[model samples]
Target: MTLREFMVQRQPALCERWLDLLLADYGEETAANWRRERDPFANPIGHTFTTEAPRLVEAVSGDGKFDTVAAAALEAIIKIRSVQELAPSRAIAFVYMLRDVIRGELGTELARGAHATALATVDRRIERLALLAFDVYVRCREQVFRLRQDELKRSVASLLRRWHGSELPEPASEEVVHLSPPPNHAVRR
Candidate 1:
């Protein structure tokens, strides 16, 4: 069988292995808890892993074109990691871990020359996924940093007001633009 065929046949097992490796990074107890809790509301990170990992596996092994749904899934996972304050390397390591999962699953089939082209295709697709994930990770980290910066600004402003017993005046502008729409505008159906 072709590598893609094999990958499709093995996708569920591959995704589970990928998720297991991912949860392993969280330590044994948390991993077990995540594994056991199937409810998305109760265990969102675990839910994301269970739901999205399969999409990722299918994306890698199917048409090889990473689609928007897969990108969004990657974002969901990355956003969680970014908020958790993991180092960028740790946050994005799951993407790289998929490579090992696929390699391990393929085993001797990869060593045999039968599906070398298909294997290369899968590797290339995986590389593209990793690059996309890095982009998502960088964006998420930037957002987290911006949030922290904004919080710091708010805290300092609050402290200043409490210490000085006055609210800071809003910035004065010479010309203000009103954003309200005209009252005489016609209503459209």
Candidate 2:
């Protein structure tokens, strides 16, 4: 199923997890404040991570599915961090803002006396947002990987230069080298 459909289907569980995390971070009082600000918008979306994102992540540790969701959330968080230099709490707040927008626009009934149409419209919108969020997450991850790879290359090059060894090959110019398989030993008699 699509990510949006999966999230919607598992909304209740996810929300519970998210709530647990929020409470842990901000304590009951801060969680209550978050609920006041966020719960209203969460109703229509069928799921939310407002207070529960971190809690859900903790619950999913070592479980593959939860790890996947956490990875996506992390990537998105990283992108926001790189661009805005936000503190972790502030970055999470921005995630809530985006979630609110999705919930508000995609969870609303559109037009009068057309419930089916409204549902379809909302589904489409949610799917779109899911795609956008996923893309943002991927792009952020790719950028991070590129940065690390570049740093590693630079380090290796510097070490080689310091040793006064033969010039190291350019990372980009090096092709992926695969070893050939050994010849088969058994033959029909």
Candidate 3:
């Protein structure tokens, strides 16, 4: 079989294994439920894997110019994982699972030397995907941090407003509200 055909044939198993490994840290129950639950709302993690992994595999195997699509897929995965209780390393490490799959599936063909370059190319692409995942992961984290900071600011402002009994806040309670009677009304002829 041609290299591309082999890769295509193995995509399902690759994605399944990848998802299992990715969720393994959450424990066997999470991994098992993720595999079992096909519902999008109940098992978004599994949904993302089933939905994006095939496209990613295609992008990785495409001739030239797959980076954009691959990055999109990686970013989507990162966004979902980032919201979960995941460390940054664990969040992006799923990208490496593809490398493991490729190595295992293609090892014999790669050993024949005829397809060494092809195997190397795929490996290189997987590395690039990891970098993309990291970049996306960082951006996702920054967004989360910013959202938290905004929430904190809003909560503080609300508390201060409640304490001061007005929407406008003062540095000190002694500050006077000087309402100079409307100048135009006072000057009306």
TM-score of each: 0.77, 0.31, 0.75
1 or 3, greater by TM-score: 1
lDDT of each: 0.75, 0.43, 0.70
Alpha carbon deviation, residue 134, candidate 2 (Å): 2.0
Off by over 4 Å in 1: 152-189
By lDDT, who's the top model here?
1
Question: Model 2: per-residue lDDT, tens digit, 59-78?
Answer: 22222223344444444334
Over 4 Å off in model 2, which ranges? 1-114, 156-189
Count of backbone clashes, every candidate in sequence: 0, 5, 0
Tens digits of lDDT, candidate 3, 37-70: 9999988878887788887888667674554556
Error of 2 at 154 (Å): 2.4
| Pairwise lDDT winner, candidates 1 and 3 | 1
In Å, residue 21's CA in model 1 sits off its true spot by 0.9
Regions of candidate 3 where Cα sits further than 4 Å from its true position: 156-189
